[model samples]
Structure formats: C-alpha cells, structure tokens
Target: MTVRFELYSTWGCHLCEQAEQMLQQAGLSGQYQVLDIVDHAHLFEQYRVLIPVLACRHTKATLGWPFDQAQLTAWLQLQLQED
Candidate 1:
C-alpha cells in the first residue's frame, strides 16, 4: 500500500500555501493530502504555530515546519522503506 502523507495547514497562512506549492513543485500532488486546520478548531489550535507540519498517517510521525525538499523526500523515503 502507498503511504499517505498529510500536511496540517490553515487559511490566510502564507507559509501553508508555500508548503503546498513546494509539495506540488516537488511533484507531490495527488500523492499526499492537505488538511486545512481552519475548519477544525481543535487541530488548528494545536498546530497553529506549527502550520505546514507534515505527518505520516499510519505511523503518526510528525515533521514540524521549516522543512526543505531534501528533508521531506528523505523522511518519506525512510518511512516507505520501513517494514
């Protein structure tokens, strides 16, 4: 099965948009899901400062903000190679 990666984000967040665009430009569209925190008060509250966070759905491994292409790719590769 393909691993599903998720990005925690919100509206009016420039960084969130940047992250989304980075993912897309990195050719990650349709491979991962983006969850807008604005619609979920609880999640938004928990991850407001940590917007643009990435998470592995199955393992729940979270990667906080300020990640780059290499970091994102390496993280996903590590997860995918795990048994």
Candidate 2:
C-alpha cells in the first residue's frame, strides 16, 4: 500500500520516538511510513539535525518537530485539502 505520509527519523532519538507515539496517538499508524535518514544519503543530509520531520507525500508539505496532536491533525487536514 502507498503511504500518505513519511516520517523522517533515526534510531536512538528520543524525540523521534515521541513523534512516532504522537503519530500513533493521532491514529495515523497505517497512513504513514517511518524512514531512517541514515539509510538514505540525501535524507540524512537534509534531516540529520531535523529528525522526526513529518512529510506529506501527496502535497510535499512538511511539519517539523515540537508538534502536538492538534497541530498534526491540522496539518493533515491542510495537506488533504491541498491534495
């Protein structure tokens, strides 16, 4: 299945873990995929310091860290509307 969102992250990152939990709590567990930046050279370069970035595949929109569930939901709504 094609995922609507991509979560850029890496291992051993507390914030990244929290972001995953947030996604789960927001009921987006299946609509997204977690991508390890370490496994992709360009992603590593772009998100090394910006781990836990949430990107919408459909609209190419991104939401960085420090986001709560409400913010995430709002972003998703915006992206869906854009699509």
Candidate 3:
C-alpha cells in the first residue's frame, strides 16, 4: 500500500522549494499533497513558522525543516515501521 503525506508550504519560499526537491530525490514524489498554508488560517497558524514541514496524514507525524537526505530517509523508515 502507498503511504499518504502532506507538505505544508507557502509561495515564494526557497526552503520549501529545496525541500520539495529533496522529496523528489528521495523518490517520494506523487505520494503527497502540497498544501499552501496561506490559503488556510488553521494551517497557517499551525505551520507558519515551519513552512517546509513533511507530515504523514494518517499518523499526524511531522518532519520540520533543516533535514538532510539521511534524516529524511530515517524518518520515512520509522514511519513505515510504525505501520
């Protein structure tokens, strides 16, 4: 089964772009939705300061910014193991 995820981000953010690139490089593309926090007040409040957050929809688990490829991989592994 495919895992679901969401990426909380806003426009004009270089970090968000970089995070997206990392997601693609990590072979996680097309399995997630990209949500622009600016369009939703609640999401904005929740992730305003953490624009590049990657979250598991089912578990509500989050990975914030400043993550490298290894960390991203490890996080994904942990999420998979949890299932």
The most accurate candidate by TM-score is 2
Candidate 2, which ten residues in sequence have the lowest lDDT sum? 22-31
Angstrom error at residue 5, model 1: 1.4
Pairs with backbone N, CA or C atoms under 3 Å apart (clashes), candidate 2: none
* Prediction 2 TM-score vs. true: 0.92
How well does each candidate superpose onto the true structure, as a TM-score? 0.81, 0.92, 0.91
Greater lDDT among 1 and 3 belongs to 3
Residue 63, candidate 1: how far off, in angstroms? 1.0
**How many residue pairs clash in each candidate at the backbone level?**
0, 0, 0
Give one digit per residue, the lDDT tens place, for model 2 in 6-70.
Answer: 99999899999999999888888788999999999999999899878999998998999889889
**Model 2 lDDT at residue 58:** 86
- Clash pairs (backbone) in predicted model 1: none
Model 3 misplaced stretches (Cα beyond 4 Å): 1-3
lDDT of 3 by residue, 1-83 (tens): 36488889999999999888888898887877788999999999988998899998777799999898899889988876775
Per-residue alpha-carbon lDDT of candidate 1 for residues 1-83, written as tens digits (9 for 90 to 100): 35378889877888888888877876777777888988889878889888889887777788888988788778877766762
Q: Is candidate 1 or 2 superior in lDDT?
A: 2
Show where candidate 1 strays beyond 4 Å.
Answer: 1-3
Ranking by TM-score: 2, 3, 1
